[model samples]
Target: MPKSLWKIISRTFFFLLIPIILFAEVSGLSHSMMHKMELLVLQLGVIIFVAKGMSILFEKIKIPGVVGELTAGIIIGPYLLGGIPLPGFEHGFFGTYLALNPGATLPVSPELYGIATIASVLLLFMVGLETNFSLFLRLSATGVIVGIAGVIVSFLLGAWTGMLLLDLPFLHPETLFLGVISTATSVGITGRILTERRKMDTPEGVTILAAAVIDDVLGIVLLAVILGMIPVLNDSGQTVNWGYVLRLGAEAIGVWLLFTILGLVLSKRISNFLKIFKGINVPAIMAFGLALLLAGIFEKAGLAMIIGAYVMGLSLSKTDLNYVIQESLKSLYLFAVPVFFVVSGMMVDLSVFSSRTIIFLGLIYTLGAILAKILGCGIPLLFRKFNLLGALRVGFGMAPRAEVALIIAGIGLSTGLLSRDVFGMVIFMSMLTTVSTPPILDSLFKKEKMGTTEELLPAESVVTEFSLPTLETVEFVSAKSLQLFRDEGFFINQMEMGHKYYHIRKNDIFITMICKPNGIYFESSPDDTHYVKTLMYESFVELNEIINDLKDITKPESLKNDFMEGKDDKRVDLRRVLDPGCIRLNLRGSSKKEIIEELVDILDSQYQITDKKGVFEAVWEREQSFSTGMKNGLAIPHARTDNVGAITLAVGIHRKGVNFESLDGEPSRVFVLLLSPKHKTVPHIQILAHIAAVMSKEDAVRKILDCKTPQAVYQFLTESEG
Candidate 1:
């Protein structure tokens, strides 16, 4: 049989067996034992397929693949598409032979339960693995402060809300336990948002992350306390046992501390030990087994299995083996993480929403969740001098409850503190927050520019200062400046008049510029003197040749470099060598073609051209069929072509502007000429974006307009990079 035909036949058989499996499993008779066994195999296979398919679909939509997996469960679960209902054959099946009858009272299959438990534990462990300890350490202090404040505020709000909303007596045990649930911050949701936004390293992001971490710690403690309190609260006539409460607290803390220390120590040794097993073919499986072992230990200690998984992650994080472990776990996470989510969705009772009470609870939960984080976390920022809006933004940023919320809800359900209604409500809240965050953040910071002096400028006392732009800052800079560098190191050195500068020194390259600034006096040691001078001299000569070529073609008297005695006589300042380089050539022509041709002639004459085999092979400009005059009377004409070294840039000032189609459909006044090497121009392109960003600033553009010499333009680009 052809491969395609065989695949079709396999799929057909699988589909056909779905009904057969369902029927045999549902049947309670002895004769259908074989069918029941076959059904089990088929069900597992089908569920896995459905789950993986749904996960892929979710990934395509940019939602977590887990969401899709859960949706898959709903499709195959009893709540939606009914499972097969076998009425007989229970006795004949192996399940019946083993005395494991499939009566209605059998509930869910034990195999399914076991799979779910394993998946849940592994999922939590993966979450632990992803935790960035270095980031946590860097932001530890602020994070702890912010996290604690947020947790306290949210917890208080939740507790208070529960107290006010519940009709039960103030002393009721259930109400208190419910309050504890309300106080929990969904770390999972917050972590996802932090990761997605790439704000995991931001002060605000780090704080939120750290706070969530601490919140989980405290939240678990609170849960234990509340659970313990339940018996006391319910026994109205009995006195509370403070000793037992203290003992439980001590035990919990001792266990947490012991595990944390053990994790820290074990993490140090993990890399070294793993090295010994380097020749082992299944390192991933080994790492996973370790995670399982740790998880089991934590569970045996009466702690949450997820806690153990988290500790395992924390332990491994300190080792070089962390990345390897993370990589190895990717397959499991991809395959099994979705199972947890799907199981979660399968457990959802959709009909619960029809009840007014359930709906009301969900509403209350959502409102409380928002208010809790905002009031809890946001209020403290005011004390730190953040204005109301800033504080609100911070609060709202931390509001969404996700992974942690689900985890907590699961635990609550398993422990019997929360019923299905509460679990469902929490899930609903988690979804609401997760969906609302991106838009909320987008609106809050949409027009907010990054890399302002406040963010980039170093403190006055610091001898050297540097700034790392936020993603928003990078975007703004890219839009406005002609060239930008991200995370590139820059060094500046000043040499005395007679001192020799070398380019070979490891760090002595003078005038080392990365992103925006163009020219400044750079200091280099004698060793690096040659390389630095060569780079600078070559760049300068190349630029000048371009200018001279342009002047030759245009032949405008005003564009000539000759110095006139009175009005035209401008003294050339060598000090301007320390500034960014700029050159402007004026071209006068009757038609656009004449002007462009003259421009091209200048490039061909000026720059030394090298030929290479590739996509962009020669110097040429395209009209782009339209002018790129985006706004503010500026025009950008750019072209990509052959083996050009570095970046060849030219500027033209058309006294009477050309009729290039602007974005506003207006004529352009300024023409900015750009030529990039066909390949390896990504760096040059970044620089061009930086320049555009600079020009987007009205002040910066005006400064460019005031300049007359090539030296002046050089000053702007060089100094800006600084």
Candidate 2:
């Protein structure tokens, strides 16, 4: 069968299954025991697809993907489209499970919730591993003041708002829960924005991060206290036992601090222990297994599992294994994180909003939440080195609450401390804060220096930077440096594969290397600067030696012939960028320069080239150094210059071959001209490589030479790969 026909039939079958699935749901077939697994599969598919689509739309509008994922869940949740009655599911496909009580907090099934819980644990674990332990300590003084102040103020405002708006007594469980939830902020969200703005190493950025870390710690402790209070407060009407609550909160803090300190202290030993399992995968998996075990222990100890997971990650954050574990678990993170966010959103029951009072409470509560963070976190900065603008930046930075807030609110709803109406209000507040933070933070920091000179401290780590002429040279140096490190008995860890980032350690000596597009950066101790420079000088000397050796044995004519005549197993589609109007069936030019001029004129006539004469000159300059003419009747003339706006192509054929100074001393019949903007030149090399590989086929060249019209030639090229 034809490929096109098969594609159409397959698409038709897929479209036809949609109605079948819907009919099955309507007929109650999906509710059967045998189809339960099928239902879960369908639910996952819809969740992932819709989540990605909504995330893309939100990202286009400059909002975070997390907010979009939440929006996706709300749209498809049981309270809205997911609640429409089907045959057996009177409340729709994703409706609340029958096993739960009427006023249950969760709308999805217990199994899905379980998955989301696991995802949350993993997400927290990843966050912990990525935390900068050294930087946290360096900025802890300011961070502590900002973080504590923010938490206290936010909690008071949130609790007070609940009491005033709901006519509840002070210290009510709902009020306390509200206060606890308000104290939490999303570290991931804040760090992402700072990193995007290139302010992560700045004074305000580091301070915000430090404060965020402390915020998480304090928030978790407060959550533990509230959880302890819930049972006692429920039994006694606002008559709480202060002694037991304080002790419980103290115990929680002690446990957290003890583990955190021990983990940081033994991080090196733990890293060495994990290194027993060779390769990145095993060690990474082993580290994650430890995280899971710790999480379970935390749960057993009557704390959130995420707390244990966070401790384990923080312990490993300072180790050499940190980046390796993060890189290995990336796929798992991508798969699970979205599930957690979407499920959190799914718990939002919009039915509560039918009450005008609930809507009013939500709006008013959201306003209070916003004000609480701004005042709470910002005020502490004024006492330090921050100006009003800096204080505002730090305050806005901490205002956006996300993952931790949801986790706390989930605890409230599950334990029956918070009603569904109040839960919806919490979700409303989280969404608004998260959605509004980025643009506001971005606008405030634009071209403004918010920190005093005395407070803005440089990082302690000594950095050695090198600027290179090209990306290829940087990559070459990086590879050579890795080998040199290995030769010197250093352990090498590739943190990010695509970016060519590496972390190498040998006993007391530790170094980090990163290869950017235009340069390489090295980070090490101050005492190791000389050692680093020595290694770099050695690399340059070795490179120079290699260049000198090549000069003695190189033959330009032989090399050109070998490159052009070489056949490749791979095929690339060149027809997509090749316009039909750019092809010439017959060439009137009989010389090399004339053929190039003819092709340039074709590009100009098609309006693909801006500066036609400049482009022609650029291509000729490249040709003068070495002939583009190959062994066969083929020639590829290309140039990257400012004359072209984008990658453009023009092809011409000469029935009567022209003298193009071919390597094999033969005439040229086929000419392919390529041009690209100098600023955007990466694709230029790729297309040139593709043309050299594809045109090596003698039979393909013969067929192209016989083509009578531009349309036939274009079609043949397009279908050649297929």
Candidate 3:
């Protein structure tokens, strides 16, 4: 059978038979006596069409198609103008409408229920699969604390708002359930925003992601507890069964735990099994089967079908099969998910807004949601010294609600704790938050920059020095520093030198040198800084070895004898024997030009003078004329110059800061001078790369500013490397 022909036949069969079946049901045919298999076939077509149309609409609007699909359901159901409202069609096709409406009902049957269940489950599983646990773990402790605070605060606020707005008795069980639904934050929306903004790796992003995960788990538990109290609350404390509630809670937890463990184990096995498919379509089929089975299991366990679907997704997440599953399910999700959302939208009785009670409830709930996050996540950061802006940013980042909101609302409706109006309002809130995030975040980070050159050198008084005397010597340095030198290497020996410098004779060529005076300085260019930093760091290791040798030689006889006699209970403390120093250097010049000129002349007399602009241009031109003015008040003045004989560096600190066109639009206070040999085999660029990495860290920059002496600066740099 050709694919096109099969599709046509499928369509024809569905179109021709659906109306007949519906007419039969409406015309008083008994459900048990009637064979409505044709209606099932027709429904498949309808499901596919709605799914595809909703997906296309969502794509056009840049919203998830799931929203569209749900909207479609609402449109075709009793909630909207398009809903057919055939007597039996009000409920799901297989719902009680058929029995209740008899001859007036549509002929849709329950056979399609399995497919709907499967779709919902698989959608959730994919949510779990997409989550990155490691990224969640990396959020700073402050972020974690803030996230917890947000969840608690938001939940309480939501609960309180529910209590006040709900007209039901103060002690009504449904009110508490409504509160739980209101407090729910959808991880899906937050995840999408983080992904879109490329902030998933940042401190704020990771914290939000982790907090949302924990919040979901906690919310579900709370929902169960609330639901358990419903029967007693509704019956006015009559015939309450605490034991049953406890048993249900325990069972739910056990099932959840068992499922999680099973997912982890099955993920590994599934990954291995997928490998056998090689270039075949077996993986897709296997995934589909697995999705179905998981959904069925979750449904059996009395949890939402999506929970099982999400577990299945998590199981496949660690496997190569995940991408395969995702791709295969894309069409289904695009179609079914939108049906879900559109239906939700259709259910929105806008008339509810006219009710002052509903309006007050919505306002109160929204306020609670905002306040909960601010107080929960933001207040704790004040003690950590984060400014109000930073704390607010963190809180706002966690504010959006998404799919989880709908999930909770659905739970509310199913359990009869909330009316359709309340459920619709909750959905409205979720949509508002979800739609608002992208613009809010874009505005917040529009001026934010990353990986700027200014971040490489943050201090006003810093120096970096580099030396390349011979080819072998350069090779040694390059090997130790891992390609700190990127040009030619030559050996120099028996040359005159001064206290702070050395003169070198490479073959017949000679290079002059000068002693660096206490006030004068020489540092590696930004390019060479990494190499010099690495060499300085390696030198510390050698110093430690020398110290150990001295300690062995100077050991007291009694101590040595005690050790040999096996009477010593403690090991020698090497750290106690070493003396550490701190360094700070501050230099002031009339201008950046005077500073660079004076510092360069002091380093060496023979070194050629290069214009700052020319040097900047040279470095930029090499990498497509890029400026290394990484914002945040730092600039790395680097160039691969031919004027120097070796890979050299000169660091100049500007107390007044220099105009280096930093990305952050701030003055540059630190400069790294880079000199690469005209030709060399060593990768000198690696040194600069490493140094940039070190400087990028906020804490490291702070430590650098705290140094009080040259030796201290050296020690800080060396200790930081470790």
On lDDT, the candidate that comes out on top is: 2
Worst 10-residue lDDT window for candidate 1 reads: 560-569
lDDT of each: 0.56, 0.81, 0.54
> What's the TM for model 1?
0.56
Runs in model 3 with CA error above 4 Å? 1-70, 84-114, 140-148, 169-171, 232-234, 237-251, 273-281, 298-302, 346-356, 380-390, 449-722
TM-scores for all candidates: the values are 0.56, 0.86, 0.52
Better of 1 and 3 by TM-score: 1
Alpha-carbon lDDT of model 1: 0.56
Worst 10 residues of 2 by lDDT: 96-105
Give a tens-digit lDDT track for model 2, residues 1-722.
Answer: 45654565466447535633565545444446556666676667667766766676687678999999988888778878777775555556577363334656677876778878888889889879978877888889989988899889988998899999888877788888888888898887788788778788788888888888888879888888788777777543478889999898888988888888988898889888898998748988898888999889877877888898999999998876776788789888888888878877888887887889888888888888878888988887777877888888888888888888988887787777888788889998889889888788888778566565365776668989989976768988888877888888676777654566788877567798988888899999898889889998898888889889987898788777566655542445566579999999788997788999999999999999888899999999888978899857889988878888888889999988999888778898889998988866356777777777678776767888989899988887776555
Off by over 4 Å in 2: 1-36, 86-91, 96-103, 234-236, 459-463, 483-517, 523-525, 541-577, 584-598, 609-625, 639-648, 653-659, 667-669, 674-722
Model 3 agreement with the true structure over 622-718: per-residue lDDT tens digits: 4344455444444444555554444555444555676665565677665555545544553356445544554555654445555655566556544
Q: On a 0 to 100 scale, what is the lDDT of residue 395 in model 1? A: 77
Ranking by TM-score: 2, 1, 3
